[model samples]
Target: MGTNICVTFFAFLCLIALSNAQTQFLRWCVISEAEQKKCQDLKKVAASMYANRVPSYEVIPLIECVLGKDVYNCMEKIQDNDADIMALDTGQAYFGGRYYNMMPFLAEKYSPGGAGTGTGDGMNYYAVIVAKRGSQFNVFQLQDKRACFPGVGTAAGWLYPIGEFVKKNGQTNIMQVTECNAIVKTATNFFKSMCLPGALTSFYNPFGNNPARICELCSGFLEKKCSTDDPFAGYDGAFKCMSEDAGDVAFLRHDTVAQMAMNSSYMPDNYELLCPNGMRVPVTDYMTCNYGSIPANTVMTSSLKTKPEVDVYKNFLLKAAQWFGPSGQYRNQFDMFSSQPWGYFNRRNLLFTDSTQTLVDVGEKNTYYSWVDNDFYQIMEYHNACPLITARLCVISKQEKKKCEKMMMAFNAKDLRPSLDCIKGKGTDDCMKLISKGDADMVMLDPGDVYLAGKKYGLEPFVVEDYGNMNASVHVVAVARKRDHYMTLFNLKKKRACLPGIGRGDGWIIPMNIFIETEQFIPQHCTLFENLGQLFIHSCIPGAMDKDYNPNQKPVSLCEGCAAGGFRKCQRTSEDQYFSSSGAFRCLTEKGGDIAFVKHLTVRGNTDGRRQSYWARNRRSDDYELMCKDGRRTHIDDWENCHLGQIPASAMVTAKYKSEQDRTIFWQLLNYGQQFFSSDIEGDFHLFDSGTWYNDLIFSDDAVRLMRLDKSMQDYRNYLGQDFINKVENLHKYTCVPVKPSKKSSSSHTSISLLLLAAIFILQLVV
Candidate 1:
């Protein structure tokens, strides 16, 4: 027993030693050959320090060097476990943390009194726009001028200054362009020429159509122009691009002016910083005239590392910085912040930036978002911009506006571009007018309103709500009891009819148009109300008898079959028992009506025990049959082919002047919103649900997704089809007439007309 216990203890000790051996060394990633050589030399120096028993060097782990193709490759190496640590700038650090889940452990401090000085945590610097001392431009007057940038996606070069420009001027002429790199397009249009390194690469210009002027200022030969290998490529190179008169302004770090001044003949006093508020100050005034304060470059590692493991790497870096830093004891052995010894003086920032004063622990601000300035971080979040323009959605009611606001927040949370804003209008007509006047960008509307908006307001439909069909349209069918075989379309001259409302698409317009097309009804002197009253013995067309709809005629038979009592009789509201699609269906089933005009879903939605209303309690969808246009009756399920007419689905309408790119972006916003907040997802908000109180707030409650219409079908007339358009036009041409009330009844009729208009306006609110 004693021997076994001793053997077990020995095995345990060996296992502990193996674990320590595995974790005692960290592999540092290097991008270039020069950086790799420097990394190898540093590793040898660290080994010698531990061998010589340098004071606290014993606690530091063994150093290893790992070669990577580039910064992005180094990030991949670290994430894939081939390497352990690498240095990254603020923008690269954000990409590392966001895409690769790497966490920042140490920060590069540039000066003794830099940001986060007192706490010895978090490193920060300022981004500045610099120009010659006496330039005729400010922040607002930069249009058509030449500009210089360090490289694409760098904090000081591209992210900070470009973000400030967008925030100030709202992205200028790029608002209507849709591209993978809208920022590049914006810069291309804003400046007459620029030297944005890597601006022509496939990663930044995926479409390869970026303007050549973006790279016209570059000094590299042939293929290397506008690339990282370009002669004008970093903070120093960007300064050279401006100093040599290649560019009018340069975007760089606050220290870049002074640092480059020491190496070149140009004096720092010759350059001035352009303030965001349009003021130009001396280079020394960077603190007051800078674009924004940004976080410093950081050493990052995989987030999968445990806290203790990260602490071990942290201690190793701290000891390396302490021993080999500028003021360290072994500075002569291995200068940690210098790159001139590696024979890469032209590419000064090799393994680490040459300007790094010392390395500091990032402490609690270890995450990329937490370490970066909040404004800079947010700007980086929307770095792609995608035309960074706001799309104003016009809503009819307060409830719809509130819902739109929530949708905007949800879309923003997911970083959907062309940010959304809500505009409240008095009604659907007001919303249409707002869109026509350019006060709003989009609004949702049914086919009836779609026609009105198209013909009168010059608006078009760009997106339609998909409710499980190809065109997202619903069939307007004439429904009747399956047992009523004698109630055919050919013999319905004196039959009782049911309809949703007077001018609604599925109810009145479609059926009335079909009657004229089939020659079942003929017009006589445009007296539609009198002709309809003569054809049908009784009808339940809600709003047909309202003074606002029939100003000169009050046909009693039109409201004879309606089920509502006293004050709600023949009203176009839910209070009237026979009002909308479901109400019209109920009128046919319970009230004395022969045929009900409604959409295909009305039967399935309110029958087969789906609806628990008293009138629809025991109804079944199979009990109803559709009256086909050929006078044949079929099951309600055959609505796709056996229908009176097919109306285009509800759609998102916008001004005809809106560019195709703007329409595409609007579709993208709604597509992304539905993906994240659709009814199937268990999120706080549902894109398709209008809650319990409203039927359709911003979109149809039955919408499964939003479908973008083809560019050919963007126009309302084309989308509604020529046949539908002609029918609607004929309905107005033959039946509609301007009426003048007789002088004997003008006063009483005007009062009654205003009251009825008020009631109809209230009824419209149900939308």
Candidate 2:
């Protein structure tokens, strides 16, 4: 019995020892040989403290070092479970968390007096521009000046300070600088020379296109130049560049100058902070004279760790700080805050920033997006902007222009590319002219205008609007009141008709082509307004009086049924009560027209309480009927078989000279815009909804989505189909006429002709 008890106790003791060893094991990733040496020494110091029963050392974990090629490699190792922890700058921490699924648990804090004193909030530091006290220039004069930066992608060194410069120089469109190399190009264009460490390495300058002047002020030689190994590569290096007169200004953290001055001959009073307003103040007033604040470096670990596991890591860091920090009793044996003793004299920050005093819990701001300031994160996003071209969209009316501008701002805010620009024109024809002249890029047009644009101005359709069905066409129907039995497709002469507009596909072109094909109406002259005037006793053809579409004799009957009071009469806009498919239906319902020409959805959209206009109140879809081409009347829902013609839907048209790539880019722009700003989204702007007053602004309000057309359907004729094109061509052959010159051009021509006649008469008299 005595032997059994002794053996059981020994087994229990061995199990306890094994459990402790397993629970205390921690592997830390290091990026440099110096960091690895420092990490090993830290392991020895931690073991010694625990064995000696140093105060608050019970939580210390057994440390092991893992070497990595760089911070990115370290992040990958931690994610893959090959390592457990690493210290990273806030910018690098963001990359790790966003790309490697790591999380930050602790942040480094600095003291106001200098490093090694543990005081400030430990969450944020200010970015500032430092220069000699009596420098002759201000912030605005930094163009073509020598500058120094810690390294590429560092918050205080590149993002915050460069963001301020971009703002001050009115580079709001700098979102166009989408890549790291593009950002370097922008910097090169603005600065005469710079010392941007790590800017020319294979990681940042993969194409070997970065300018050499970006590294002219760096102190490293040969392959180490402009790399992290460069002696001038951190906060201290940037300051040294300025102190040695290698650069006119240095971008650094607000605490950098004060911290480095503690051991050097440089005094804080010799330098001043350059305020964004172009004023200079003493470096001590950084709070009032800095560009912006960014988060500090953080100690990060894999996000897959459990809460208890994370707690263990946090507690270990806290205990290590208590024992090895500046005020610790073991400070002389192993100072965790200094790297000079570890043979890293040329490189300042190893394992941690030399300015870090102690580690603090990150608390609830543990995620990368939450831990970093939103503005600073957005600045970083600019470096990854999509490489896309910019395209201009044309708008005709003031309301459409406002909506287009809002869309541009919203798309830019989301960083969607290709970026959009809004160009305002007087009318649809003007927009077409603008696009043809290359002043604008694209516009939305109905089938009638699409044909005109293609046949007259050399434009093609690249994208088509989809209205929920695979068929990219709508039924053009002649709608009439069920009580009006006399209004058939074979209507007698001297009847009134309402048309959406002069050039609209469903409202005017299709209906007029049907009339000509059936021989119900005869064209006495090439002038459509006169022929239509003689056929119908009175008509509501909106835009009939507009000189751009007519430019002929004034027809009183065309505008007689229009409801607008003044100059807005017969205008092709929302101001005219009779201007679109819905407006034409309203004209037939209340404006004393016998027949209404519109698309199939006009009745369903405005009737049944779908529309809230006062004119459409108490209207029901059952009250309307469709006029079929076979001289038969049917219910409104029978438009699929009882319509005059089916025409293609509206499309986005651009100059035919635009390459396939250009067309694809335009399609992508609209496709992306609708994804975020579509009617289904709760965003502030709706891409498909026109306000209460307008029917369709830049695009059709009924469209649910935009789709890119197949390569074979890029041409307008092929997209509209040969049969529809033939019908339209037949109608246009009799109605279309050469546009007369404007009055000013005619007068100029007359004056030139008179001058030539007088010159000839004088020559004849001399002979």
Candidate 3:
């Protein structure tokens, strides 16, 4: 007897040890033969999958699975089990209320929720309504009317339906709004916030007495043949509001048949039980045990004190409600987003909105989706980089030892000038010295850098001839059109305006500042501001200089006849039926004689010892503004004072063109120029590149003619005709643009460049 007692005590000790091990398990019950193998192979004693409950919601069993174990991370093991059980369609047997009812009977002696209940066939797993038009309501304007909810549970219940109704009305209290975009946005938020989880995919497309997959298009309400169930099975809401498939439905989720008919804004919709073929039989509703008790969901809930939890965070009930929400966008859309390995992210590519959401930053910019539709996990692997890892213009210029800036207004790349700052002509000397020295933050270059970079772009010219015939004339001229070139020029105009990339080139440009105000096509159309130059000099001294017409006095005959006062009736062009603002007016009429419409005059304040003016022997020399001797600016409008000492025509063309600097300036105009000097010195008024009576604006006809001469516009020098060439006036700004010598760039030693230019100037001065 003593020996038997000792043996019994030893056996009892083993049993107690086993019980303790099971009870002291940690949270998270996982069930997977493969993972289980891995756990065992990895000598992991903590991880275990409980076979007791279908949904693994039996908290105690789940806790016992990992009791006293010491391992980190088991969610993956658990979710994979869910996929297994869910795929078997036995999820209801474990997660449903029937599973709860049978919990106490698992061991036949008040078992705490196990698979001992052979009664439940998973009917109450997740009951949903399948109506063509589900609880139709667009949530019209709020009226002072209490909602009516039918009490008492039906086969299709009421809480989820009623909850949806109340939730939709909740926004009415915030503000008044009406519009498809607003309505849809509001509806989506409401769905995510209040709707339950459920599936409604392909609800509009019926197949095999159910649905094949989720329907995105070709769906409608109010048609029995169109509506099915299971749309919300997956987290794919890419088709929300897809052609109004869910325009009229308000789905609902119910806990049980008894609660389905309960009246509340948050109840399900249960109609009379159907007899056969879904035919309603009011009397049969009370006859049979067709209305079975719903299985309790295996869900865990914690108290949310300060704030209520989102619907997705709630138990199975919310999941059910999602499928029946107004949009039915909830079902497949809500796939337990909060339960992901990494936390959620919005369009901004940020982590949590607040600390309450709970998250940790992982990889940052190094992570990016190669494509737009990259996986959510991939994005989480490395946080979505909405701002993206782009080449910062300033940073690139600094790092590469080269000036790099996209056009400020457009994404066009800047053409960097060769460095002049490079000491000893070293290869691409350190350009971003400021950054290296910690003087600048080294951000992206100004978006307009591309535009302004034109200042550095060398005006390289091409030589070509004989493109085509125009106006009964065979012309020989160089022309150029490289699209990118024109677009770059256009982009410069837009950047000058401080606008975003204009739509012209393949890609668009934006400033690094994130300002997106763009003038579409403005970057392209701005090309109209190209250099055309002055056609004639209006300050030709009328009928030669005489004592009567002094340099300091206005030409009385010329003024009275045509060059007189301000208001003069003239046409923008002879072809133009009427006149326009002197600005942008294309003068095409009477060729070089357009300036004769009114007396064009100029004035010089003579601020410096030297003041330049245009006049024959008959005009006043002291005029500063375009005022007549009577003291009034004239109507000719096109007039200017020479800031530098004035030179008549280039009788000295060859002479002035001798020096390299002079040649550089002269060739730019000569090759693809629109400005030239006059044979007669007294006629020395300047003209703008293109515009006005005195200026030469390229007319549509002239442009077309020019285009005809340059099939590709690849060489602009070959495009201009004798007419366009000979009409250029020396006064035109284009006639003397300083050529940016290719060999010199700003990155070079600034001190040396200044000295070089200064030395030349000093020598000239001394001479």
Candidate 4:
């Protein structure tokens, strides 16, 4: 027996020695057999391309696994401590809950050694609270309160949630530290144990019998009927339960259904639509979001240097998940989708989750803040606990991921563009194409990036008009939110102030001091003047945009302007009121009024006043007033329905009076040469639609000089101040009238020379 023992001991010692000196073994930590097989396959690929560096770039894929067999063994031998660079997450939505946002923050903060400052991987996660079946606390109630998290090391479980908590506190000035502890170790472990392999699952397994058990722990009680919301929230609970029994709640969960349900449903559609002339139509998919926007597209950290490197790193990240189990299951099944759901996996993938709730809750201090803000700032602040990326836009692509890397690699290499791109899908696809060509000037674009990219490259972004949400954009154009803001700070050579014409509306809206200062809004100003008379005609067009206007008016005859849109009756005085009118001035149509500004009409036998400005001789009587048809006179019945005697809804009035009448009455006063006024245009308000506040309306420099408003400018100083208006005055007063478009002085000599040349050519051909 003694001799056998000695032999066994000696053999064991040899085995121990063998384990210590081997150089080829990789410290892999896969827990499952399937995962182990995957790791084995990865090993073969690694050997074939170990430390492989592609042309024009240098990148290596590093992978390892942690096996529970020996907790410390896997970490014992890290082949390279931190020689090169590394990226932890794929930055895909599939893993966004664990990466994106926090990664950037960590990267921005850390300024790591060889990687320089801000080098590290990223992580994404939900701020979850795994509570018991029944607890008495709602999410909002827990604000600034203590909470538990999985761990702080990874971006998913710890950093993002902590950051969210800080963002909620309004300022990072005094956020309390979170108390995260291991489930198996802390009192909170009760919630963890329920979801573990033990008891068929917990009251909160999301699939268990009494879901209230889990909800109570996290949300206090479950009202049976749908009170309003839930992550997977219902109307309400069958009943409430005690607090301590409340297990936990995953406040900011993974790609889990519970975490995403609220955000997806919180907002309805985004646009207020209308058909031309107030026509009725079904408008879905109009605008589906506001105070909301799509998440970031792509991001990069110090993880890779070239596009290929980024691709490789992303692939490695996929491989990392191979250890979880069957691509779905895990040692902890509750966390399964923390890796899959669509919101976490969309192309522009999100960076954080709990931040969504944070945004909504902190509305008091920071209205309109998005989960994106905290996400971006976290990446900026952290620099990188590991290695992070710096992306001009929040979204990034692995393919071009390494492009930034290459830039950093060559000291002399220059970047004429930013490392990011963003875009908005507004109106038509043709507009999207404009982004590539740099046409639209989006106000939402990050000015920092605009300056960087604009200065780098010789490119610029210009404005294009035609579409925008009417509520905001009335003037100049806006660009793709993702496009660079090259010109915002560069001071556009202010175009000369344009005089208010038939095209410029009610002058401009008086300064919008009431609704303009809340958020970081873009200059939604416009330059393409919507004619003043046109605005009235356009807005009052019956049946056009009726659904959009939902106007409240009792249609009275003013023959002046529509009564909706804050255009109610003005009280000029008690004696001279239409709807109890109060003005000394009564609106009247010049002989040029009611013209077919949009169409031309012919003389088809009119014995009425019959001169100019009238067309469609139908229903018009010889004694009725006349109006212009495209600046030419035409006979017509009274323009106001009151005078025309209200034609039957079933009958076309034009046909009743005269068979050929298709004329519709649209009125306007003629304001051709009025200084600071248009007979065609009413109201002395500044135009906000085109952001021409004091600059263009009332007085163009040329108009002022011609009207001599320049000397008179002082007279109108109280009304038209000199701020941005000076640029308008200087340009317009001195600017030359557009050179006449007529053909240059005709050259009879040139014509004769041409004829001679023709003759010579003919002779040459004959020869």
Candidate 5:
């Protein structure tokens, strides 16, 4: 009985060990038995490559039966966690990411002929429109002209070029009229004859349910319709279609003609390229003639994996690429990417790009949309029958009315909505008023005005514009020249200072709030403006330069440090040496003041004369340093770990009284506009116009995203204190203000603030 029990225990132990082994190695899915055998063979190759060191990878084949045309099914397997990775065509990659919720992390980089493949410059190839050299026609003359496409849904061959044609013809709204039928109907009507592989197949077109003529132009053999297996189906096939005089023009990848010219049957000199701008060039000059670059295909993954699991998989693939590159010693021993091992693969080349290139993380899910051009995705949206949402943006303009209209024209050209509509405002303040009063939907405001609008004008900040490398909240720093010795906010006491304006957040409110919070001084401590002058030895306040601009309506000692009797003295104009952040930093740099309380970026922008202004262009960055909290000075980049508190960025404000739906739609509208126009490709639509007469448009030029202003903004407001906020709002001195809180109450407040901040961080993580 004891011997039998020992045997049973040993068997159970073996089962557990096998299960653990299965979990350790990656499960690479192979489509057929033959491919499965090849996968096993490659494992030996992988082992050989890493023979000199400990192998960082182990892959086991998971066999499944699937057809080449049914690549989408394999993607579904990845989504369902039945498979781990696969190499898909670019179109399949898009569909998987968009609909099936899969991730594409690596793309194949192929070598052309014998030399290295692709430009090896991190750039993808382009789709070219090719026609016979003698054919006298541009892209626009394709009305009833014969057309040939390599395949349906191929990025370079069909989508990019067709998308360009549709946009030029103003059929961007074609999706609303017809679904997938939009492309079919448009192409069929525009072209006289065509040979589009897969257009009639169920993979692309409906099986016998759609119109009969959809496949009429296709040259298929007895009952074998539009299969990629057909010789006349890919780039070579499309070229053949044109060369045989069966089609007048062909839409294929840029290198197709050059590649085919190597064949005895084809001549490169016979073809020319149709440029999108109604021009023509020889086929060999396709680099300049072709459409914009398309993204390469990727080996995708599902979002279900943990970070460690994802990292392991990514590392293994990267190791494989490095091991198999041309210069690697293992290159002669094995061709891991070759098609001979994988029977049902799409192309007769390696699984990865010809030569091993870098593997980029495209992220999981629909985030892959950025890889595809905004124009192409918009076209895909139309073709896929997705609703196009347009929101109208209210432009707050004063004198640049025509320029606002021109900006709108540029925006519409890129098709961002709600399209901006200019609503003339008397000034910046008036624009905020218009938005609050429901006369306009939204307006961008400076930090100070945003605070004012939110507290008193019934408007709430939804999005904050990003500037430079900083986050939505900027630091309100106290700047001092390197020669000065200062430590902490306390050192600023009784020092000559420069402020951009009395009403500006960075210049006044934030600094004053810090002073009050630190208990160094109180507003009640000074009854007259004379107290402010006493607080500082002398000060330059630009807003108070004009007698009517001060909130207290008393110029008093605020203008004592003005730029002498010149018009620039204490003036709010750009010509004023201390009018803005740059100006205030200049005031400190030029020795106008012992210290300058300006935005964090101000010191960095003007140091060493990086400024565009004539006065600041020669300043040296090394001449100044930031004062830290521990009474030590450090380099400017170290401000995060030391120095003044951060303030919120400029915000896009809207009436707080609006319906939830209205507010939600307004936020969505702005977010959409930012997403499309923020990319380098959309430079034509300058959402933040640097060249305009106005310094900034609705957003800052460096703005990346518009995040919801949740607790961080509230923290900043809380730091300012309700009493100080009210004092600013009433524009008057306070007689009876609540005394500073007891230590116990302050501790309770601190605990509560920490909890709220933790909650906000958790919420962001969840999102």
Candidate 6:
């Protein structure tokens, strides 16, 4: 028994020694010799970053997993768990994801023209067909032509040209056909000869056994050279093919020729673009002349990893990227892309994106169809086209869902560039929340709500509604009867004032901000809203239903002057006497309140015998006047120089994740609808709401054109004034706090009330 125990202990010690001897490193898969070399440098930098603690990038141990000779083998190693991760062009990423059970966890971000910052949509570059400047050939005359391609499945170099051909043929909206076999057959038959490195061994290859015609235009020798295994296979190889005059046309990524031209070995002026429209442009005009862009290179992993393991890998890669990217001091030592030695950067981006903050989860499918922009999806699916595309619009409104459906119908009826879909939400806030949660796409927002949606909900404004004037800002003014005793901003402090609503820009938010800024009301001294309520005495500010808007709820102050529930009180709609611009003006005329906070032109438009509304039909222009900042009163026409600061026009906001292509398409559709419908004012179909139909659906009728807002969410705060933004944010925080008593407090108060009732009963009996 003792001898047996000794033998088992000795065996355990041997196993421990064996485990210690085998070195376990985080394997990074590499496809080529150059990539293998980069892996070494990556290992060194990662070691340094891992050791340092200041800006820790440490997550996974570093090692090279170069067990494969090519991208296909590299992916195979990943699938078998022999390797961990690798970066591939978007096309190869799709291929790996489709057949090899791989998933993408990161995408490369590139700055075009070496700009300071890159846009999310700038991830992809253009693909072009370059030919000699004096060549007489155009896209139409390319039949039976000798062609040179960078690689078999390369996006900009190969798929783009083939996709363009398929687009011209008009096939499917399904994105990519499995293995690209159908298009490869078409290309082999169309071209008299071609040199597409890796094409012979690729899964998509059509002429597998026919070696003569397939390799006729190839440059390398024997079985070892002239294919993807050769060093000069990508942009460099295609350019070599062009220079040697081996092929009449070469398909390459945009700026490749220009970048090579910077080396003096190639002349930029010797080449031109062969456009799909049968027009030719200079090589420098690649932006307008080249084939549409392909998706950017993506970092992918094999399905061997579980969900949690994949997440850990993603986190590690993203951290490594931050430590070695453009923002890091180690950029001189490492890069995230292969644009090195081309005046772009010295090191290549091996495992991370160029500028994206984080990797988006394209999910387990990772297919080409998962790419946003259905137009591109369809084009790539059916005809293999790479034209610019748009996303489906997600509208946010329950009451206006039908109107949105109608708008969708109208948009589809005309076959507009982008289509619209309606997503129902209870209210504006709910809609903004839906956008934040990625359920809804976009909605038109007032200035105050724009602030809330942008700062509080992480939404961004894509379009600002225009009201004919180039200046999209409006004037907020204080209006009152000329005979009223209120002569200045200070004089109306304790007076009963009429405002549009609690959350509105012109009515309540803007006015309250002015009061706070001018020292009329100090938020710090107020208990809930008692200070403001006391200052205003018994003022009427419509839509102040919640305690957050009016904490002194028991006083029945703001609601006192409000019309009955059915007739409208401080609502934004026309039914309320103390609602919008016109409604606030009517509040003063009807003696509901003394002063009205509204837009500069509200009183002017409602009075002077030009008014058409039932309440303003008999009103005269001289009765109402504007209150100037300098304790002076002026006529409504002179409100230009005597009003609150400028207010931004209502804007359309969407989630930041919405692609640029989709935003452009949405803007185009809306702009087209506005222009087409506004042209025929009497037409049954109107883009905006009328007296009783489609009221406040999408945008206000006062808006003319939809303008793009250049300001970001932070920039919006600056545009709206930082002090005002801070106050509004503070107010929102205060309002969001539950004002109702806690359970304990309620119970204690209930017990005291019961005691008082018993005491009252006893006193009555004794009496």
Top-scoring candidate (lDDT): 2
Clashing residue pair totals per candidate (backbone < 3 A): 0, 1, 113, 146, 15, 16
Runs of candidate 3 exceeding 4 Å displacement = 1-24, 28-250, 253-445, 450-767
Q: Model 6: per-residue lDDT, tens digit, 638-679?
A: 877788766877778777656675565556567656654552
Q: How far does residue 303 in candidate 6 sit from its true spot (Å)? A: 62
Candidate that beats the other on lDDT, 5 or 6, i.e. the better one: 6
Q: Which ten residues in a row are the worst by lDDT in model 5? A: 173-182
Q: Write the per-residue lDDT of candidate 1 for residues 617-686, one digit (tens) a residue.
A: 7898888899888878998888888988888888999887778778877776776667678887877788
Whichever of 3 and 5 has more TM-score, that candidate is 5
- Backbone clash tally for model 1? 0
lDDT at residue 241 of model 5 (Cα atoms): 76
Predicted candidate 4 versus true structure: per-residue lDDT over 536-616, tens digit per residue = 232122111122111222222212332223322221111112111000001111122121111001111122333221222
Candidates' C-alpha lDDT: 0.76, 0.77, 0.21, 0.23, 0.59, 0.63
Which clashing pairs does model 2 show?
198-226
Give candidate 4 regions above 4 Å deviation. Answer: 1-38, 41-133, 140-147, 153-156, 168-247, 257-374, 378-767
Candidate 6 structure lDDT? 0.63
lDDT of 5 by residue, 176-283 (tens): 222223366557766676777666644354323445554555566755445554445666667777888878888877767766654246777788889977798877
Off by over 4 Å in 6: 1-413, 485-487, 517-528, 537-540, 547-555, 564-578, 607-613, 616-620, 692-697, 711-715, 718-767
**Per-model TM values vs. the true structure:** 0.59, 0.54, 0.18, 0.20, 0.43, 0.44
Please, what are the lDDT tens digits per residue for candidate 2 over residues 1-767?
99889766754553444444434568999865677888988876666566545344244466789998666778889999999999887767877887689999998877654332322465567888999988898877888899999887678778777765544234444223423225676787788999987677544554477888989899877866776656677878899899889999999888778767766688888999888877999988887787776777899999998887888789878878887887877788888877764566545667777767788998998988788877776666555343445789987777788889999998877556667899988778888778877788999888988887777676789888887786788889999898888778887478888898887798777988888777787775566677788778988888888775676736789878888888778787666878778778988889558899988878887788876667776798998899988899999989888988888999999987677767866776687678778887876788887666666667776778888889898888899998877867666556655433233322444577799999999999999
lDDT of 3: 0.21
Error in Å for residue 398 of model 5: 6.9
TM-score for candidate 1, residues paired by index: 0.59
lDDT of 3 at 224: 16
Full ranking by TM-score: 1, 2, 6, 5, 4, 3
Candidate of highest TM-score: 1
Model 6, residue 680: distance off in Å is: 7.5
Please state every model's RMSD to the true fold in angstroms: 11.5, 13.7, 30.2, 30.9, 21.4, 28.7
